[model samples]
Target: MNLRWGVAGLGRGASFVEWLSAIDGCEVVAVCDVSEAALQRFDGLQTYSDYSEFLEKSHLDVVAVITPGPEHATQSLAAMEAGCHVLSETPCVYSIEEAQAIVDVARRTGLKFMLAEDYIWMGWCQNLKKIVDAGKLGDIIFAEAEYTHDCRGGMLVDADGKHYPASAWGSREDLTPTWRAADLPPLFYCSHTLGPLLYLMQDRCTTAIGLNTGAKVAPEVCPVDMESGLLQTAGGRAIRLTNGFCIAHPFSLFTGLYGSRGSIRMVNLGGLQVKAWFEDDPDGGWQDLAMEYEEREDGHHWVTVMLEEFIAAIRADTDPPVDVYRSMEYTLPGICAHVSAEQGGKVVEVPDLRKS
Candidate 1:
């Protein structure tokens, strides 16, 4: 069945138009953004500055909600209410309450709701999943993941909502801090670190405890420079997550999985690099693994693969891989972690929204 699509928030959502237009049986019919300059970039497609008007007039069967993190839940609800299936960018929801609401709306509407989480679909992550499933990783007991992207330069935004380095605020009088810069606890952005690990383990976090470096860097613009979360999964496994977007470091995604018989380390230092060790390795040393997979031909492997899967789920009228429940599994623990950090490392329970 051919699907008509509408994309809200052009900053990141613009990519969806190109992707969906290339996918078979999908048409990007409308684009929406508050920025007229952004809307102008898509010359032929229908465009709207107002979200409600876009939903009402777009004649869409699907909506990709790619706005800022704070708008994800409400935009998803609105899209589902308008009879459009939703594919939302992460972190899907900020709080347990928001997660529960998304689940309720999705259930009531019987619409496909997918969290557009790409990390799990990366080649190395997929490879790790295969190793674990094959028992090569053998009874995974502990894991560590870190997303240490230095975003200090983009902490503050100008009058037009364009981001500039926080260091540039002194040279400009009208600069204001972004919400993530001023109020977002680093742990709240943990989906990138948690989602793939949860997917690989096929588990959900039950409790989380965390701590943060209390605005040690860029104190006036950002609340915390780094935060760490220790999560206990339902399967009696432990996962450690470190998230820091404001520190001085090169952008990186790193994950280490420890198991009874073997271990895996995957890091994205500009490019994917994978290393592993097994009990009977020929030399008993870390073996470097290739990161390329057959799916790389599909263009932007992770994003393309994830989008195609979401579309396939919709076409089959089935739950998406990262459906509402799984999205919460990948997202809510981070919120719990943030609460834990705020409470001086007190353990916080992550609500299973499926049971709510």
Candidate 2:
């Protein structure tokens, strides 16, 4: 069945426009952005600068929010309340309370709510999950994942290969500081780094402790550009994550998984490498693996995969692949980590939203 779609927040939402417009069973019924300028780029569609009006008028079955990270929870709650399924871009909400509230909403509405955590669908992550599920990795002992993209205070690059300040794009008619990434604590965006590992482990972090790598170098909101932290799972497995967006570093997702018998690593430097090892191997050695995967002739691999699964779940009238429960499991630790940093690296308990 074809699904009617509306996208809110058109900066990044513009890409959602192109993507959904291309999907076979979806229509871009309407689009919204606080910026009238951003809406102009998407021709021949209903557009609104205000979210409430967009929801009320747009004939939509689902609304994907690609706006600022901070606005996600409120916009998602609005979409669901308006009878639209929600697909929110990462770090679904900033706090456990927000996470719990959205989970409750999805349950009450009986609608699909999926966090667009693309890292979980990335080729290396999927492959690593496969290795673990096959028991080649044995019982997982510990894991480390990092999302280190140094924007150096909102360096948002455009299609022409020119870099612009993030605030410049997110700003409105007044040009106030609306750039989400500028002031956002790095840890607030940790779902990308933490989500895949949690997805692979099939576990939730029960507790988290964080260290703030002071924002004396920070460009905006929080005083810290990076918040490094450790999370402990209910099963006692340890997970480490760092949301390092401020410091000077090449853009890379360096993920490592350590299990009782085997391990895997995704190293992104001059190029990408997927390396792994198993205890039963003759040499018991780490070796580089093939990075090749089935290519998509039509669209972006991870995004297309995500959209198909989302559509399939809706069509089947079944739970989404990444449902609300799993969404919190991937998102809450980062929220807790931020709290921990605020409290001077104190361990903050991560509430399990799945618990009744």
Candidate 3:
């Protein structure tokens, strides 16, 4: 069954359209954005400046919410209410309240509500999970994940030119206004680094202690504000997540897992290295087990994998790997991490969303 997708937010939605255009069983039947100029890029598809109007008129099976971080909940709820499934971008919702609302609506509607956390679907990350589950990494203990990018220049440009922060794409007049008219925390954009580790471990993060560097290097550039969080899981695993608009570092998104018997580290978008350390001999030192590269013309193709999984879940009548609840679990740490940091590095207990 082909999944008819109505894509929202043309900036990032353009990539989804490009990917769906290539996939056989998926179709971009409708597009929506506040910017007519951006909507004009797509030909022979229904376009709308208002999302509510698009949902009411478009014959869509799924609405892909590729809008900014803050707009996910409202748009997703609207789609679900309109009798369509929703696939939203990472960090599912800006706040726990919004997350709960989306979850409640999905349960009541019995429609698929997936969080597009593509890092968990990366080829290298998936391979690592397989190897670890196969006892190649023995009993896992500690893991570290990082998502660092030097977006100072971009932040400065966006803030000065548009009078909004770098990550505030929704605030752009060209985009639809689905976000709450309130300020958002920085650590909310951290699923890319946290999702992969949680999936590989196959366990929820029970507790988190976060230390935020309350340093606003360029307040003018990042007027929305930002902070970094260091989280420690209940099982004594450590995950350091950093998200800010004005950091002075090269872009990096990677995870390193240390187990009782072996270790594996992956440097995504840098060198694409997935190396494992295993006990080679009883008397000797450890050895490195490297993963062979599978070349894709367009890098990892994570978003494509996510869409494929969504379509397969629809066909199989089962929840996707990154379902609403599972995705919520992955996202909670990011939310709590920010709270922890704001509270002067205090440890915060992540609410058990599975229960309530």
Candidate 4:
């Protein structure tokens, strides 16, 4: 069955549509974006500047919402309500109420609702999940994931030395509109750091306490230079997650799992070197591990693997791997953590939207 697909928000949406088109059973039929330049990416496919009209006319079976943080919830809801299953970029919704709305609509419609937290399906992370599933690690008791990238360089000017964000960005050159990313709290973007760990643990965070180093990059940058969350899972497990963009650091995405019988830890910050400790290992010496790619000939690109699974689930009429319930679990904790940080490290309950 060739599932017709529509994509909204041509930022990451361009990459997403390209990938979806590569899959044999998926067709990119319609694309929507407000920017005329972005529309250039979809030449033959239908394009709409208005999202509501795109949903109304596309007749898509699936829609991927890859807009900025604030737009995810509204766009995804409209897509689902229009009879298209959704794959949303994280943090799937900005608020718990939005999360619940998605849960309600998805449950009521019996359509696939997935949060596209591609880090969770990273080859090394998947390997760790397999190890935990095989009882190599008895039970996941603690975990941590770090997502760090210094994005300031890409903000003010392009690599081609073009100034931006100075109010009429594409128009007046001298005045710049406040970039929407300026107010986005660091943890508001924490799904890339926290999602994979929760996905691997298959658990929800019950509470989160947050601490942040307030922004130092610029007056208009993310108001958090660094953000860390101390989270307790629903099963009484501990987890730590950290994300920040203002820091001067190499782009490193890492996850660590500490379990009852054994533990797996990444040895380097940005690199894939890993060390594991188990009861059966003689003298408790560490052994390095790396992701072994079997299914992919192009190596371990996690994003494609994730998209493949999403399409497969739609084809099989099954729930998406990272359903909205689990999506909320991965997202709501970070949302609460952001609240905690703003409230001076007061612990906040990570609401489970599935309840009532």
Candidate 5:
């Protein structure tokens, strides 16, 4: 059965809809965006300026909530209530209330809900998962991940919706901060850093304590420059996550896993590279693992793989790999981490919304 798909938000959603349309059993039938200019991009497909009207008219079997971070929770719930399954972008819910609400509604409606956390499906991450599963990394006792991309370049928008760097706002009086520039504390956007770590360890965060390097980089436009979350799993594993968008750094995603027997690390400094050392290896020194492709190709490959898995789950009437509960596991810790950061690194418990 070809599932009818409607996409919300045309910025990233345009790319997603293209990929969804390319899938054999998925049809991109509708798209919704507040901007008429964006809607015009998908000329042949149905488009809407208002989301509610799109939901009513699209007759979509699935809705991809790829809007802004703050809009994800509300949009996902509305789609599920409208009798459509949902595939939402990361940091799925902004608050614990939103998380619980999504969990409740998804359970009550028996609809499929998946978080589009493609980082976990990256080739290096997948390789790490395989090594961990094979007991090469032993028991993962601690992990660290960082996503320090400099986003200050795209932080401001003019009245005409033309984006400019945060620095450009000084010359233009009509520039406004983009949603991402002034969004939640940086740690709240830690899914990219935390998701792949947890995916490899197969654990959920139970508690988190966080700290932030206050908005020193782009204080005028950005809320926070950098934030770090120290999370603890139920099995006594520790995971450290650092997320920064406005900091002065070349785009880098780094992860290091330390286990009882050995450790492995992967980073995108100049390029993607993985280093590993196992206790039982003949040589006791770290060895570099060959990375097949750069980050761009890896990203495209993962999103395709992730969408295929989601489509397969929807067709089989089963839970997606990153279902509602796991979505919260990947997301809620960062929410609580943000709270912890606000409270001066007080330990915050991540609610198990599955029980609620």
Candidate 6:
């Protein structure tokens, strides 16, 4: 069954459009964005600047919420209410309340709600998961993941290799006093770094102690605020997650899982170089494991894997791998970590969404 998709929010939504264009079982039937220029970029696809109008006329099977961080919950709830499934971008909602509300709407509608936590689906991360599930890593003790980038100059890049102006979102006069205040918290964008760790460990974070430096070092270059913090999971394991768009240069994006018997490290995006080290090899002894996967020119095509999984769930009447509940499991910690940072770095207990 081809999943007819109505894509909302054009910036990152454009990536989803490119991905769906390649998938056999998915079609981008309608596109909606606040920008007319964004709508003009796609040829021959039904487009709308107003999402409500798009929903009323598109007759879509799924609505992909690719809007800004603050708009996810409202848009996702609207999509579910319109008798369509929803696939939202990460940091699924700005707060736990919003996440719970979206989850509730999905439950009430009996529709699939998925968070596009793609890092968990990367080829390299999948290989690491296979090894850990095979008991090669033994019991996991501690893990660390970093999504550090020196995008302080700017987050987006244009076709000419020039950085897009940071003022596209909002003007300097409209920003908050500090960088952190200018945009969403750094922990709010933690899923890219946290998803692989949670999936590999098969564990949820029980509590988190977040430490944030409230300084706005480069207010002019990158307006978005930033923060860094440490996360401790339930099984006495710990993982440090850092999200700062204000850093100098694009550095490392990595995750390391240390188990009783050995440990695995996935470096760069798509698990490019996954390294495994056994306890016996203490001195300069680590084997480089081939990722063993082909790279797609358009890496976004991996979203097809996620779409196929959702379609399979619809056919078999089973929940997808990144279902609403699972997405919340990955998201709640980041929410709590932000709350922890706000409370002067207090350790906050992540709420158990599994309970009513």
Q: What's the TM-score of every candidate structure?
A: 0.96, 0.90, 0.86, 0.90, 0.97, 0.87
lDDT of 1 by residue, 6-63 (tens): 9998887888888888988899989999899899999999999999999999889999
Better of 3 and 6 by TM-score: 6
lDDT of each: 0.88, 0.80, 0.73, 0.80, 0.89, 0.76
Query: Model 1: how far is 38 from its true place, Å?
Result: 0.5
For every candidate, C-alpha RMSD to the true structure in Å: 1.7, 3.7, 4.5, 3.4, 1.7, 4.2
Between prediction 3 and prediction 4, the one with superior TM-score is 4
lDDT by residue for model 6 over 1-356, one digit each (tens)? 67899999887789889887777777899999877878999878999989899999999998989987778888988888899988888778887788778778877888998889886766667777778898878899888877766554454344432344454435433322222234567788888888878888877888887877664665544444566667777777888887776655465677788889898887775336778987766574789888743343336445677777877886676887888888887887877888888888898887667674
Task: Order the candidates by lDDT, highest first.
Answer: 5, 1, 2, 4, 6, 3
The count of residue-pair clashes in candidate 4 stands at 6
lDDT of 3 by residue, 153-198 (tens): 3442231223344455445545321231123455677787778787
Highest-TM-score candidate: 5
Give, for candidate 5, the lowest lDDT window spanning 10 residues: 291-300
lDDT of 2 by residue, 1-356 (tens): 67999998877778888878888989998999877777888779998988899999877899998988888899999999889899999878887888889989988889999998877776766767678889998998999988888675545544433445544644533333324445477778888888888888888899999988776553443357678889999988999998777677868878888988888887777578888898899987888877633233333587778888998898888988899888888888887888888899999998877784
- Writing each residue's lDDT as its tens digit, candidate 4 over 281-344 gives 7777777776642233347457878888888888888878887788888788888998999999
Model 4 bad stretches (over 4 Å): 157-180, 267-270, 292-301
Q: Clashes per prediction?
A: 1, 3, 0, 6, 0, 3
Worst 10 residues of 3 by lDDT: 175-184
User: Candidate 6: which pairs clash?
Assistant: 150-249, 179-225, 180-225
After aligning candidate 3 to the native by TM-score, how far in Å is the CA of 318 from where it should be? 0.8
Leading candidate by lDDT:
5
TM-score of 5: 0.97
| Model 1 residue 60 distance off true place after TM-score fit, in angstroms | 1.4
Give candidate 3's TM-score. Answer: 0.86
